[model samples]
Target: MSTVEVILQSCLSKPAGNSLLVEQYVSDTASGRRYLLGRNEHAAEIMQMIEVDGIIDDFATNGTTWNNKPVLTTEQLPDQSMVVNCAMCIAPVSAARRLQKHGAIEILSLAELCSHLPQRFKLPWFVSQTRDEIRNHLSAWNSLSTALVDKQSQQTLNDLLHFRLSGDYHYMSGYSVRPEEQYFEPFIEPSAAHVFVDGGGYDGDTTEQFCHRYPGYRQVYLFEPTPTNLANARRRLKHQRNITFIAQGLSDQQGSLPFDTEAGSASAVDPQSSQQIQVTTLDQAVSEPISFIKMDLEGWELQALQGARIHIQDDRPSLAIAVYHQAADFRRIFDYVTGLYPDYQVYLRHYTEGWSETIMYFIPANIKQN
Candidate 1:
């Protein structure tokens, strides 16, 4: 059987009682010390679910405390202590190795500890919705595997699928850590006359990188909706020349929508949010020819792309769009962009070791493809 079919079969079967094993471990180690390997937003929630002796953070100094529990460096952790990793942003395998080197007898990721818990803790790109979407769009998923431009991208898709399906970090062991080079692929030659657009510009980090990489770029149009984030972006890019900051979110249509600002980087268009923010379509926002466009909107990429149909059809701007927001995006975004301009070469690159930061690059046929 093909790898995809084998994965489908495994997913179709009932998942093993891994949560039960976690429960048994916790019960057996009640008298022993239990430490959380890393600290993140979910650390407190994990503590609430299970008993934790202390928190271990590599960056924390002496006498620091998180959730009233002492925070110790990995070197300070007692030998043979059981640890549950709470750092969702880092690679699980790397985190496990670090703890093991520091004398952790057993380790469990936050995902494993709360795998059977409420859905909110499941994290992005691997939620139940993603699994359902994959099951429903198996044909699209299969097509995506073969549609990728290079062998590495296909392997990335395969590894990510296995990791998502099994919740096993072992599949990510081969992924290289290269978030600093995201959105700017080596194959994409930097030009002096590049007109860049930074959609969902948060703190002007990506724009800053663009300025450094393309020093003589013509202009930059950064679109950010959140007032605080927009202010920060403006402050960060104040010295940069030929830059315009648009304090509005990108979407299919122009209007105001409820937004949630509490989630920080994950803040997005949440209908349940009481706060509202203005949004506009890319077609209506920019009329000039754009050479490159990078979008990392939380989950509003498709709608924004729909709004930029005219620019995409006319200018054929190089695109670095985040497809990791939703599972169907692995196929849906590829379909939408290819449908708009069939000649565009498609490529996929993942920044993080985990499921986040998967960008789908759409380079116009006019650009050199390596």
Candidate 2:
């Protein structure tokens, strides 16, 4: 008999709704791996009467089995006709789209299971933004959880997550694009006249937001590696005279690096690609006391940090580093900053749905941040 049959046989007397289990994240090094192990066992029991067939995940681990059943990858999910999709809370939009294409009857997660299930399974953590108790509970997932942030910042993260997941921002702060993210963060001021650097300045949308937030910056250095993006950014910022444009990649070193251009605004230097782009270190590019930096280098955040180490250490500019490219980045980026600038306190903010666009904000704890 197939694995699906066995699961169905085990639930012979249960309700007959079909189910598909999707593990949104599976990390081999972090707690995610262990959580995956538990989810593997939990997949069979929906905490509801719905019948479960098999498990699916995009993490795509090899040579792994759950309850002696082969844990299927996202690619393998369609083969088994599934009805309900029990996915990670706030899975990427792409994944949801793929599952929709496959005709998943319903998409649910641990946090949402209670809403669908007859009884709430004693899940480790449930998510609820409407209630501070649940929000505060799950906010402890990291040192930079929502519970630790200011009430406004906490509301901002929760509201952004809600909008990302459900297309609703009723609870969000007025600012959709957080140019000066820590605007709610007190006692922090822009250093000097403000030498703002916009990494991956696609079409200058962020630049526009930055200007709107604080129009008095001395100079704005905009970097867009692609010919296409640079042209559009130039057109967008044509009237803005205080801006300098660089048509190259930013990296940890001042040298050429390979890049994948097909990814659009997320394009970055790739060592294996045949393509090449001029790349430079921010430290090598500028000598002034830096004030604010905003980087969305796709997956090159860490390398870019290495490039700006001196500026960050000496000038102590307010940092907004993107840390969602790789799961390791979530922790590694924070560690890198804290190791270099121990005086700085690290906080995290997540934007976008699924598992993308999580920004880590590092501010000097010496300031009055309540």
Candidate 3:
């Protein structure tokens, strides 16, 4: 039976809707057997019963079972209720507590978790709602027993959003772009304080897109380190009087380092990849006010953010950062950025509608004033 089913069965013998006392029996690599004693009122309720305040222990002293009997000794349970010793049954509960401790598992906040959410989620509000829903539904699955399933579902959601936003799908136009994202009327306009910073100006695809839709952008700054990409960006934007191209990669440190170019998207200034290149610091770039920044610099996001401390603090511009390159991208980047700028209203969005692209949006709390 499923872990939830067994837990519910164990609690249903007496009460059907209150918390019940539940203990666990677990084995360790060093200790032959061990017991995890605790009280979980919430889990008990989820298991369909209320746990009375009582001591529950797992005393499986014997090393093995006998006559098809469990080796662990335990206090007598309520009459008509069988002892629950299934490792699979209690595994999920154990994991749930651990994930909660690490601050990695939780249902979305009530306001964030709206009702009647669209199942076939798309961009803008739909994207935010879908992720919040997944986190809420799978909060219990973040533990070891169901971690694999939880991770797989997370990946699938990431991919679905990526594919929808990559701007390659034929159906992209049919989804009804957000008013802020529309090419005109409501699209982001350029201002004297506005300077577009492209962290990974790969052949200036972003530049071309920006210029095509919002060419009046006050000043365009492209950061491309690859010889091929740098040359292309230079050729493409050379005629634009407001555009400036930099042949450097931003990193945590302000020094040159090797970058793995072979992995392509996996390229890094560290040993994580095969190709290598010298890196620069964002501090070395423009000192003027920047209105918007788009980062697609592989997995060097943390280090890049560090180097841009001055820019972020001084400019306080809008950010569209790619977070798919690293495993803990969501937690690390989101917490770090938002923690530093508490007043900024951070919005998560995936522009790539594919398997592993997750782009996040960061705007000052007063972004709507613009």
Candidate 4:
């Protein structure tokens, strides 16, 4: 297990009376970068996972703190201060309760540092082109989005419109999943035996929902590399008879790979990154009837899918993939899937309003012949 994993296991193994929730994020500044730690009941868990004083002291020693930027550390955080972002939303305070009360953060530009936060997350992103830049990008995206939108496209638009208006139909409430059956149901019905390969299964929520709804499935296999996520997935599915959880990650090759980030967040084995883990391909590791596959790998969707080419061609399972990670991923994944199985009907939908896009795939009732 990785260092983070060990700490997470220790956290989860604690007594039931203990309730803790800790979150970490990156705080970038002109001088340097520092880690932001947030805690509720589980402040101790955060302490166990990180070198608290060390990390804080590093930033302090570098003189990165006490900046004009709006970030709240353990010492510097204000009780009710606001943090602004220049990219997605305006007045994006580091609190969700505030976000729910207020909708849409104002978009600011790098040049408008005086107007908004001085810097935006300068990471490689799919929708990096600001809202102002969308018009220029639309022309390039036209062909790709057009191709991805199938017959259900119109209905999806209608549903999305309704959802935006009233947060119904397309949205889910709590643990209860709203059943509109947009496009993923067709492929799941007829399979005599089914196996679901959940690549980025977090806390096993999706897998639990799948098993709860479809209890007769052969097995649900989960590949979560992070020790925290993997342990939680195991704990969640411990009572289930038809589930197998693995600590290894699914990648294009077989070897130890860095996860690149903290546990339970975005993980990768791209060699160039920091945190990594052992990798294995689906074809080499799996030996069952994989009827459905769901991938939410931060940006490694293509690599993970490519590793499952044999399964994609042979099983042709329904896919729930996050296509908003990379700009070309929408087109790239569509082309890759359709190129192998031309008859498979593709249906796309963006589940959340912001963040990223969740695209779904539905195979035709039967294989189409040329």
**Using lDDT as the measure, which candidate wins?**
1
Candidate 2, superposed: residue stretches over 4 Å from native? 1-193, 366-370
For every candidate in turn, the CA RMSD to the true structure comes to 3.6, 13.6, 18.8, 14.3
Residue 368 local lDDT, model 2? 30
Clash list (residue pairs), candidate 1? none
- The sequence of per-residue lDDT tens digits that candidate 3 reaches over residues 17-131 is 1112222111112322222222233223212322222222343444543323233323332322222211111232332233234342121111111111223212233234434
Residue 170, model 4: lDDT of: 16
Alpha-carbon lDDT of model 3: 0.48
Tens-digit lDDT string for candidate 1 (1-370) = 5566677677445343367756655676465568887776667766766667898888888899988899988778777777776654447677767787865467776556545553535443364656787778877777777677888777877777766665556667887667679899875657523889999898899999999988979899999998888899999999999999999999999999899976767889998899999999999999888888899989889999999999998888889999987777878899999999988878888877677888999888765321
The Cα RMSD of model 3 versus the native structure comes to 18.8
Q: Of the candidates shown, which would achieve the greatest TM-score relative to the real structure?
A: 1
Residue 187 of model 2, lDDT score: 31
Candidate 2 residue 34 C-alpha distance from true site, Å? 31
User: Cα lDDT for residue 124, model 3?
Assistant: 30
Greater lDDT among 3 and 4 belongs to 4
Candidate 4, residues 262-320, lDDT tens digits: the string is 63455554566676677788878898657778787877878888888898888777777
TM-score-wise, the better of 1 and 2 is 1
Report every candidate's CA lDDT.
0.78, 0.57, 0.48, 0.50
Model 1 TM-score, 2 decimals: 0.86
Off by over 4 Å in 1: 10-24, 38-50, 60-71, 109-127, 191-193, 367-370
Give stretches of model 3 more than 4 Å off: 1-193, 263-266, 270-276, 367-370
